[model samples]
Target: MKKVAFVVAAAMTCVATGAQAVDPHVAVGSAQYSIGISGFVPVICRATVDATVVPTQPGQVSLGSLNEFCNNPNGYEVYADYSPNLGKASLLVDGQKVPLGNAGSTRISKSNRAGIVARSVTLDLPQDVQSGSISFRVVTL
Candidate 1:
């Protein structure tokens, strides 16, 4: 009878409990942008190229992945975190940019304050962005 009671209790517990799932979690409130670039052209590294941003209202970049999009009332921020395989890398926003000389497999993140209006980005990149899935921007530039 004791064994029967324990089995019953276990079954009951199982019925009362819910299943758990392993879901990818982001922080309380955070967003991200990830891009993949290939086919690097070192010659293009020194030239300034424009990377444009498209507006996504209440949107996040590359959902289900590391990158995300969001719409906040307290002003919006755009970030481009890049990992390039070749050449020098520099990030430009409006007019301010930072240059990184001779880097490999590196991630550099830049934040620019923005609003609902889409804006233009200038880049003096080391290697021309080859090819990769982008969480933000047009992705295919």
Candidate 2:
């Protein structure tokens, strides 16, 4: 009987210690709380052009690839502009002639959905405008 009593006391002591060891972060009858997290990525578009290459035709200047990137779900457009703004320069992409705007910028291509695209671009400059460069612009729609 004495041994059984000692064992019960020891078991009660262990249970009491274990109960005290549990520390709660929240109050006993209080409402629970939670931490919320969020993030954002802004809509963006970008265009990159590689180095100029020798033209296969005598009067045309061939340029390297024009790569485009856009994240807008609607669409994107690629434009081309030349240096010196020399009178109505002609822009060709993959051998197809792209119409020029009066403001000196022309839309070379467009996409209905967000994606990455690449195309070959070329320029036909006037004889008066020698030694010039071409630039590209990307717009998210």
Candidate 3:
């Protein structure tokens, strides 16, 4: 009698444990449900400088033009990174003058705008210094 009772109790426990485990595929009910979606856009910018060099002032050298394009909706900014060899350089962007010491970045645009546009970039360097390279950068604002 005791053996039969122990076997019955063990079988009941196994059944209870199996019932406690829930299956992921089991559906609660058939009803309407909602789904979510998302998306993103990356910032893009490009710049090109003309090779044509035209001398303006005594120490100032003006390049042909700088073409820039940015996809940012808010606006964009232009910066001039001068090389270490340059001494006392300044930039003339659309007739606006921005002074930059030997090396570092300086903002050349007075009013930030988006899309493609061409502006004049001139370099005002010391008379002794000649033949130097400067890079331009565009960033979204």
Candidate 4:
């Protein structure tokens, strides 16, 4: 009887150990992971003039015309190439400078593409301004 009882206890221990071997799992329905992913364009513009030299007689003279193209969204400005004697002359678009002739720099137009703005510039010439050549430029604002 002692031998039988010992055998029965050993069998029970083996059964208990085998029961614990079953793996328990918790259900994972869904999983997700995310990452945030993350640039500059330089402001650029071009300007061209129809004439290089403009001759004036002392009253008002029209200096051919100029066309400007700008890639900036806010548009651009045209200015007479800055010089020491630039402000001495007056540039008129309609009747006066868009801003005011400080160094002959004035804001001419504003557009998204600006395409080709053919603007004729008129200068009220002082007899002192002798015959010469002038230049214009476009810049993004």
Candidate 5:
């Protein structure tokens, strides 16, 4: 009887341990983005996230809200956009395709074509991301 009660208590405690979404430990240079100079125009940029900060699951990576900060030594205000539609942006660890996630391209960029135009989206990671080395791709729509 005591063992049964202890088992129940342990199970309850495990269930009570709610999960908190943790911010990803980003790789040193995992940056992928596309530049949209005009409506639907695109200039794609792709880079791999640092191997050190691997995703616990596929969804651990993500892109978030863009912000403005001081980047220039001369007091130039630099801007970061989560939306891939803009001219410049950062592709976060979370690069998914929701209302605010990565956009899957119906087509690939053409060699003849120099650009594309579309609304830029942010990056997203899976709720159950995998750990270890991972690859990320950033392209223009």
Candidate 6:
């Protein structure tokens, strides 16, 4: 019958090329995964000062002496910013004002994490600290 219809049309073209090589477009899908994270406490902190300028004679003027550091594990305080002719200066370490000054900062060392907590400050010159010119600075509040 015409060579059996050319062998049934070449066996239906080899079964349609083996059904397109079996891939058949089956991409069964499902996908989902996630991750996200985030940080800051960085106001670290630092301060240092050391003084001993000698040229004394009015009441033995001596407004000099300090050494400080604050790494801030959440603890720090030591301030003395003066230049108003030092008419109102009072900051001690082993005499008074351990934590008793507001506008001039007098809370010297209390909280510490040991990163940079070194202190040795003394400058109580208030007898009208005079000598012609003056300046001071040691802060980390």
* Predictions in order: lDDT: 0.34, 0.70, 0.69, 0.62, 0.31, 0.47
lDDT of 6 at 76: 58
Query: In model 1, what is the error at residue 72, expressed in angstroms?
Result: 1.6
TM-score of each: 0.29, 0.60, 0.59, 0.53, 0.19, 0.24
Using TM-score, rank the candidates from best to worst. Answer: 2, 3, 4, 1, 6, 5
Question: Model 6 — TM-score against the truth?
Answer: 0.24
Instruction: For candidate 2, write residues 21-73 as lDDT tens digits.
Output: 55333222233333334568898899887865443343567677888899999
Error of 3 at 87 (Å): 3.5
Candidate number with the higher TM-score (2 or 4): 2
Choose 2 or 4, whichever is better by lDDT. Answer: 2
Give lDDT tens digits, candidate 3, residues 1-141. 999999997896665445444433333323422233456878788767895444434476777688888878888887777666554667777888788775567766633556888998777776666566677888788
Q: How would you encode candidate 1's per-residue C-alpha lDDT over 17-115 as one tens digit per residue?
A: 322112223112223322333464321111112323423222122122222222332333333444453134454434455453444322323233212
- Kindly indicate the candidate among 1 and 5 with the higher TM-score: 1
**Where in model 3 is the C-alpha error above 4 Å?**
1-41, 52-58, 110-113
Model 4 lDDT per residue over 23-120, tens place: 22222223422222222666668877666666657867776666777777776777666444444667676565643345545555666554556777
Where model 2 places Cα greater than 4 Å from the true spot, the runs are 1-39, 52-58
Task: Compare the candidates by TM-score and give the number of the best one.
Answer: 2
How does model 1 fare in lDDT?
A: 0.34
Colliding residue pairs in candidate 3: none
Best-performing candidate as measured by lDDT: 2
- When summed lDDT is taken over every stretch of 10 residues in candidate 2, the lowest stretch is 26-35
**Poorest lDDT segment (10 consecutive residues) of candidate 4:** 24-33
